[model samples]
Target: MSNDFYRLSILPHVAIVIKICRAYTNSQEDFEDYYQEVCLQIWRSKDNFKEQCEWSTWVYKISLNVCLTLLKKKKNNYQNFASDSLPEEAIVESHAFADESLNQLFDAIRQLSEVDRGVILLYLEEKSYQEIADIIGTNANNIGVRITRIKERLKKLLDGKIN
Candidate 1:
Protein backbone atom coordinates (compact mmCIF):
# COMPACT_ATOMS: atom_id res chain seq x y z
CA MET A 1 0.00 0.00 0.00
CA SER A 2 1.11 3.54 -0.63
CA ASN A 3 1.76 5.85 2.31
CA ASP A 4 -1.59 7.59 2.14
CA PHE A 5 -3.48 4.32 1.66
CA TYR A 6 -1.62 2.68 4.50
CA ARG A 7 -2.32 5.59 6.80
CA LEU A 8 -6.01 5.61 5.93
CA SER A 9 -6.36 1.86 6.20
CA ILE A 10 -4.69 1.62 9.59
CA LEU A 11 -5.92 4.83 11.16
CA PRO A 12 -9.39 3.60 12.09
CA HIS A 13 -7.98 0.50 13.75
CA VAL A 14 -5.40 2.23 15.91
CA ALA A 15 -7.42 1.79 19.08
CA ILE A 16 -7.41 -1.96 18.55
CA VAL A 17 -3.65 -1.81 18.36
CA ILE A 18 -3.40 0.32 21.47
CA LYS A 19 -5.63 -1.87 23.62
CA ILE A 20 -3.84 -5.07 22.60
CA CYS A 21 -0.44 -3.49 23.03
CA ARG A 22 -1.34 -2.10 26.43
CA ALA A 23 -2.40 -5.50 27.70
CA TYR A 24 0.86 -7.01 26.52
CA THR A 25 3.17 -4.25 27.81
CA ASN A 26 3.73 -3.05 31.35
CA SER A 27 5.61 0.16 30.63
CA GLN A 28 4.74 3.13 28.46
CA GLU A 29 7.92 2.58 26.47
CA ASP A 30 7.09 -1.03 25.72
CA PHE A 31 3.55 -0.06 24.79
CA GLU A 32 4.78 2.52 22.31
CA ASP A 33 7.23 0.03 20.84
CA TYR A 34 4.52 -2.57 20.45
CA TYR A 35 2.14 -0.08 18.88
CA GLN A 36 4.68 1.13 16.35
CA GLU A 37 5.79 -2.41 15.53
CA VAL A 38 2.21 -3.49 14.94
CA CYS A 39 1.62 -0.64 12.55
CA LEU A 40 4.82 -1.38 10.71
CA GLN A 41 4.03 -5.06 10.45
CA ILE A 42 0.57 -4.25 9.18
CA TRP A 43 2.06 -2.07 6.49
CA ARG A 44 4.56 -4.73 5.52
CA SER A 45 1.91 -7.43 5.56
CA LYS A 46 -0.67 -5.45 3.58
CA ASP A 47 0.03 -7.22 0.32
CA ASN A 48 -0.64 -10.54 2.02
CA PHE A 49 -4.15 -9.49 2.85
CA LYS A 50 -6.71 -11.61 1.09
CA GLU A 51 -10.40 -10.72 1.27
CA GLN A 52 -10.88 -13.57 3.72
CA CYS A 53 -12.07 -11.34 6.56
CA GLU A 54 -13.15 -7.82 7.29
CA TRP A 55 -10.30 -5.31 7.32
CA SER A 56 -10.84 -4.69 11.01
CA THR A 57 -10.66 -8.40 11.76
CA TRP A 58 -7.44 -8.55 9.82
CA VAL A 59 -6.17 -5.64 11.86
CA TYR A 60 -7.12 -7.40 15.09
CA LYS A 61 -5.28 -10.53 14.05
CA ILE A 62 -2.20 -8.53 13.10
CA SER A 63 -2.26 -6.51 16.31
CA LEU A 64 -2.56 -9.57 18.52
CA ASN A 65 0.19 -11.44 16.68
CA VAL A 66 2.59 -8.52 16.88
CA CYS A 67 1.96 -8.04 20.57
CA LEU A 68 2.41 -11.73 21.30
CA THR A 69 5.59 -11.97 19.27
CA LEU A 70 7.09 -8.80 20.73
CA LEU A 71 6.12 -9.88 24.25
CA LYS A 72 7.84 -13.24 23.76
CA LYS A 73 10.94 -11.48 22.51
CA LYS A 74 10.90 -9.18 25.52
CA LYS A 75 10.57 -12.11 27.89
CA ASN A 76 13.49 -13.89 26.24
CA ASN A 77 15.79 -10.84 26.23
CA TYR A 78 15.09 -9.33 29.65
CA GLN A 79 14.17 -10.18 33.20
CA ASN A 80 10.46 -10.80 33.40
CA PHE A 81 8.59 -8.34 35.59
CA ALA A 82 5.30 -9.93 36.51
CA SER A 83 2.49 -7.42 36.33
CA ASP A 84 1.01 -8.28 39.73
CA SER A 85 4.34 -7.53 41.32
CA LEU A 86 4.64 -4.00 40.00
CA PRO A 87 4.58 -1.29 42.66
CA GLU A 88 1.50 0.93 42.80
CA GLU A 89 3.48 3.99 41.74
CA ALA A 90 4.99 2.25 38.72
CA ILE A 91 1.65 0.95 37.47
CA VAL A 92 0.20 4.44 37.75
CA GLU A 93 3.16 5.96 35.99
CA SER A 94 3.47 3.37 33.25
CA HIS A 95 -0.10 3.33 31.96
CA ALA A 96 -1.38 6.26 29.91
CA PHE A 97 -4.96 6.08 31.17
CA ALA A 98 -5.95 8.67 33.76
CA ASP A 99 -9.00 6.80 35.03
CA GLU A 100 -8.23 4.64 38.04
CA SER A 101 -10.84 2.09 37.06
CA LEU A 102 -9.59 1.88 33.50
CA ASN A 103 -6.07 1.44 34.81
CA GLN A 104 -7.30 -1.21 37.21
CA LEU A 105 -9.10 -3.04 34.40
CA PHE A 106 -5.89 -3.09 32.38
CA ASP A 107 -3.88 -4.20 35.43
CA ALA A 108 -6.32 -7.08 35.91
CA ILE A 109 -6.11 -7.77 32.20
CA ARG A 110 -2.33 -7.87 32.40
CA GLN A 111 -2.60 -10.66 34.94
CA LEU A 112 -4.54 -12.86 32.52
CA SER A 113 -2.82 -15.42 30.34
CA GLU A 114 -1.65 -13.71 27.16
CA VAL A 115 -4.17 -15.58 25.05
CA ASP A 116 -6.95 -14.71 27.42
CA ARG A 117 -5.90 -11.09 27.30
CA GLY A 118 -6.34 -11.12 23.53
CA VAL A 119 -9.66 -12.89 23.81
CA ILE A 120 -11.06 -10.46 26.34
CA LEU A 121 -9.87 -7.43 24.47
CA LEU A 122 -11.65 -8.62 21.34
CA TYR A 123 -14.69 -9.45 23.39
CA LEU A 124 -14.73 -5.94 24.84
CA GLU A 125 -14.45 -4.57 21.33
CA GLU A 126 -17.82 -6.26 20.68
CA LYS A 127 -16.44 -8.64 18.14
CA SER A 128 -18.66 -11.67 17.74
CA TYR A 129 -17.43 -14.94 19.22
CA GLN A 130 -16.71 -16.35 15.79
CA GLU A 131 -14.79 -13.20 14.90
CA ILE A 132 -12.71 -13.59 18.02
CA ALA A 133 -12.19 -17.25 17.24
CA ASP A 134 -11.10 -16.39 13.72
CA ILE A 135 -8.50 -13.96 15.06
CA ILE A 136 -7.40 -16.05 18.04
CA GLY A 137 -7.45 -19.32 16.08
CA THR A 138 -10.02 -21.14 18.15
CA ASN A 139 -13.55 -22.40 17.69
CA ALA A 140 -16.46 -20.11 18.44
CA ASN A 141 -17.57 -22.48 21.19
CA ASN A 142 -14.15 -22.28 22.78
CA ILE A 143 -14.21 -18.51 22.55
CA GLY A 144 -17.55 -18.36 24.33
CA VAL A 145 -16.38 -20.64 27.14
CA ARG A 146 -13.12 -18.79 27.49
CA ILE A 147 -14.80 -15.42 27.62
CA THR A 148 -17.04 -16.57 30.48
CA ARG A 149 -14.11 -17.86 32.46
CA ILE A 150 -12.04 -14.80 31.67
CA LYS A 151 -14.80 -12.54 32.87
CA GLU A 152 -15.16 -14.42 36.15
CA ARG A 153 -11.42 -14.29 36.68
CA LEU A 154 -11.30 -10.58 35.91
CA LYS A 155 -14.14 -9.88 38.31
CA LYS A 156 -12.20 -11.58 41.06
CA LEU A 157 -9.09 -9.71 40.13
CA LEU A 158 -10.95 -6.43 40.21
CA ASP A 159 -13.32 -7.32 43.05
CA GLY A 160 -12.69 -4.12 44.94
CA LYS A 161 -10.70 -1.99 42.56
CA ILE A 162 -13.43 -1.27 40.01
CA ASN A 163 -17.07 -0.41 40.64
Candidate 2:
Protein backbone atom coordinates (compact mmCIF):
# COMPACT_ATOMS: atom_id res chain seq x y z
CA MET A 1 0.00 0.00 0.00
CA SER A 2 1.13 3.54 -0.74
CA ASN A 3 1.93 5.92 2.13
CA ASP A 4 -0.91 8.25 1.22
CA PHE A 5 -3.47 5.46 1.06
CA TYR A 6 -2.36 4.08 4.41
CA ARG A 7 -2.48 7.54 5.91
CA LEU A 8 -6.00 8.24 4.71
CA SER A 9 -7.82 4.87 4.78
CA ILE A 10 -5.88 3.12 7.57
CA LEU A 11 -4.01 5.54 9.80
CA PRO A 12 -7.27 7.09 10.90
CA HIS A 13 -8.48 3.68 12.04
CA VAL A 14 -5.20 1.84 12.60
CA ALA A 15 -5.89 1.20 16.25
CA ILE A 16 -9.01 -0.79 15.48
CA VAL A 17 -7.15 -3.06 13.06
CA ILE A 18 -4.08 -3.32 15.24
CA LYS A 19 -6.03 -4.33 18.33
CA ILE A 20 -7.94 -6.99 16.44
CA CYS A 21 -4.71 -8.32 14.94
CA ARG A 22 -3.02 -8.34 18.33
CA ALA A 23 -5.80 -10.26 20.03
CA TYR A 24 -5.80 -13.01 17.38
CA THR A 25 -2.11 -13.70 16.79
CA ASN A 26 0.13 -15.82 18.97
CA SER A 27 3.38 -14.06 18.01
CA GLN A 28 4.74 -10.86 16.52
CA GLU A 29 5.31 -12.37 13.07
CA ASP A 30 1.73 -13.55 12.90
CA PHE A 31 0.50 -10.17 14.05
CA GLU A 32 2.43 -8.46 11.28
CA ASP A 33 1.09 -10.90 8.74
CA TYR A 34 -2.47 -10.32 9.90
CA TYR A 35 -2.04 -6.55 9.96
CA GLN A 36 -0.72 -6.44 6.43
CA GLU A 37 -3.43 -8.78 5.22
CA VAL A 38 -6.12 -6.64 6.84
CA CYS A 39 -4.73 -3.49 5.23
CA LEU A 40 -4.54 -5.16 1.84
CA GLN A 41 -8.06 -6.50 2.16
CA ILE A 42 -9.30 -3.03 3.08
CA TRP A 43 -7.83 -1.55 -0.06
CA ARG A 44 -9.03 -4.48 -2.17
CA SER A 45 -12.58 -4.02 -0.94
CA LYS A 46 -12.63 -0.23 -1.14
CA ASP A 47 -15.13 -0.01 -3.96
CA ASN A 48 -17.37 -2.57 -2.29
CA PHE A 49 -17.79 -0.31 0.72
CA LYS A 50 -21.44 0.74 0.53
CA GLU A 51 -21.03 3.54 3.06
CA GLN A 52 -23.89 2.16 5.10
CA CYS A 53 -22.07 3.16 8.27
CA GLU A 54 -19.10 5.23 9.37
CA TRP A 55 -15.76 4.49 7.71
CA SER A 56 -14.28 3.45 11.00
CA THR A 57 -17.08 0.95 11.55
CA TRP A 58 -16.49 -0.53 8.10
CA VAL A 59 -12.83 -0.82 9.07
CA TYR A 60 -13.76 -2.75 12.18
CA LYS A 61 -15.81 -5.28 10.25
CA ILE A 62 -13.10 -5.85 7.65
CA SER A 63 -10.36 -6.12 10.24
CA LEU A 64 -12.31 -8.60 12.35
CA ASN A 65 -13.24 -10.73 9.34
CA VAL A 66 -9.70 -10.85 8.02
CA CYS A 67 -8.28 -11.80 11.40
CA LEU A 68 -10.84 -14.57 11.84
CA THR A 69 -10.26 -15.90 8.31
CA LEU A 70 -6.51 -15.91 8.66
CA LEU A 71 -6.73 -17.71 11.97
CA LYS A 72 -8.85 -20.42 10.41
CA LYS A 73 -6.31 -21.01 7.67
CA LYS A 74 -3.26 -23.00 8.65
CA LYS A 75 -0.12 -20.88 8.81
CA ASN A 76 1.75 -22.46 5.90
CA ASN A 77 -1.33 -22.74 3.73
CA TYR A 78 -2.16 -19.05 3.67
CA GLN A 79 -0.94 -16.97 0.75
CA ASN A 80 -0.32 -13.27 1.42
CA PHE A 81 -1.13 -10.68 -1.23
CA ALA A 82 0.34 -7.69 0.62
CA SER A 83 3.19 -5.54 -0.58
CA ASP A 84 6.62 -5.45 1.05
CA SER A 85 6.20 -1.89 2.23
CA LEU A 86 3.78 -0.99 5.00
CA PRO A 87 3.19 2.35 6.67
CA GLU A 88 4.11 0.84 10.00
CA GLU A 89 7.36 -0.46 8.49
CA ALA A 90 8.34 3.17 8.04
CA ILE A 91 7.29 3.98 11.64
CA VAL A 92 6.15 2.60 15.01
CA GLU A 93 7.05 -0.41 17.09
CA SER A 94 5.90 -3.87 16.04
CA HIS A 95 3.46 -3.91 18.95
CA ALA A 96 3.05 -1.48 21.82
CA PHE A 97 2.01 -2.70 25.25
CA ALA A 98 1.43 0.15 27.65
CA ASP A 99 1.99 -1.93 30.78
CA GLU A 100 2.41 -5.43 32.14
CA SER A 101 -1.24 -5.65 33.11
CA LEU A 102 -2.19 -4.82 29.55
CA ASN A 103 -0.02 -7.68 28.34
CA GLN A 104 -1.68 -9.97 30.88
CA LEU A 105 -5.05 -8.81 29.67
CA PHE A 106 -4.19 -9.64 26.06
CA ASP A 107 -2.81 -12.99 27.11
CA ALA A 108 -6.10 -13.78 28.77
CA ILE A 109 -7.98 -12.50 25.77
CA ARG A 110 -6.05 -14.82 23.43
CA GLN A 111 -7.42 -17.78 25.33
CA LEU A 112 -10.96 -17.00 24.32
CA SER A 113 -12.64 -18.29 21.16
CA GLU A 114 -11.96 -16.21 18.03
CA VAL A 115 -15.43 -14.59 17.98
CA ASP A 116 -15.23 -13.82 21.68
CA ARG A 117 -11.83 -12.23 21.22
CA GLY A 118 -13.28 -9.86 18.65
CA VAL A 119 -16.15 -9.07 21.00
CA ILE A 120 -13.88 -8.14 23.92
CA LEU A 121 -11.50 -6.20 21.69
CA LEU A 122 -14.42 -4.20 20.30
CA TYR A 123 -15.73 -3.74 23.81
CA LEU A 124 -12.34 -2.43 24.94
CA GLU A 125 -12.33 -0.08 21.97
CA GLU A 126 -15.45 1.50 23.53
CA LYS A 127 -17.70 0.59 20.60
CA SER A 128 -21.37 0.67 21.57
CA TYR A 129 -23.12 -2.66 22.01
CA GLN A 130 -25.21 -1.99 18.95
CA GLU A 131 -22.10 -1.35 16.87
CA ILE A 132 -20.55 -4.54 18.16
CA ALA A 133 -23.77 -6.40 17.44
CA ASP A 134 -23.69 -5.11 13.90
CA ILE A 135 -20.16 -6.41 13.37
CA ILE A 136 -20.77 -9.70 15.16
CA GLY A 137 -24.02 -10.26 13.25
CA THR A 138 -26.19 -10.37 16.36
CA ASN A 139 -28.40 -8.02 18.34
CA ALA A 140 -27.35 -5.64 21.08
CA ASN A 141 -28.92 -7.71 23.84
CA ASN A 142 -26.93 -10.81 22.88
CA ILE A 143 -23.76 -8.74 22.74
CA GLY A 144 -24.44 -7.50 26.25
CA VAL A 145 -24.88 -11.02 27.51
CA ARG A 146 -21.83 -12.25 25.61
CA ILE A 147 -19.70 -9.45 26.99
CA THR A 148 -20.67 -10.38 30.54
CA ARG A 149 -19.87 -14.03 29.92
CA ILE A 150 -16.62 -13.21 28.11
CA LYS A 151 -15.45 -11.09 31.02
CA GLU A 152 -16.08 -13.92 33.42
CA ARG A 153 -14.24 -16.34 31.12
CA LEU A 154 -11.31 -13.94 30.82
CA LYS A 155 -11.15 -13.57 34.58
CA LYS A 156 -10.94 -17.30 35.00
CA LEU A 157 -8.23 -17.57 32.35
CA LEU A 158 -6.21 -14.80 33.95
CA ASP A 159 -6.56 -16.38 37.37
CA GLY A 160 -5.03 -19.60 35.91
CA LYS A 161 -8.21 -21.51 36.55
CA ILE A 162 -8.58 -22.31 32.84
CA ASN A 163 -6.15 -22.94 30.03
TM-scores across all candidates? 0.85, 0.81
lDDT of 1 by residue, 87-143 (tens): 444443344698878888988888777788899999999999999998998899999
Per-residue lDDT of model 2, residues 22-63, tens digit only: 887656777888999999999999888998999999999999
Global lDDT of model 1 = 0.81
Residue-level lDDT for 91 in candidate 1? 45
RMSD of 2: 8.3
Measured with C-alpha atoms, the lDDT of residue 60 in candidate 2 is 93
Best-fitting candidate, measured by TM-score? Answer: 1
Give candidates' CA RMSD values in order. Answer: 3.2, 8.3
lDDT of each: 0.81, 0.78
Q: Tell me model 2's lDDT, rounded to 2 decimals.
A: 0.78
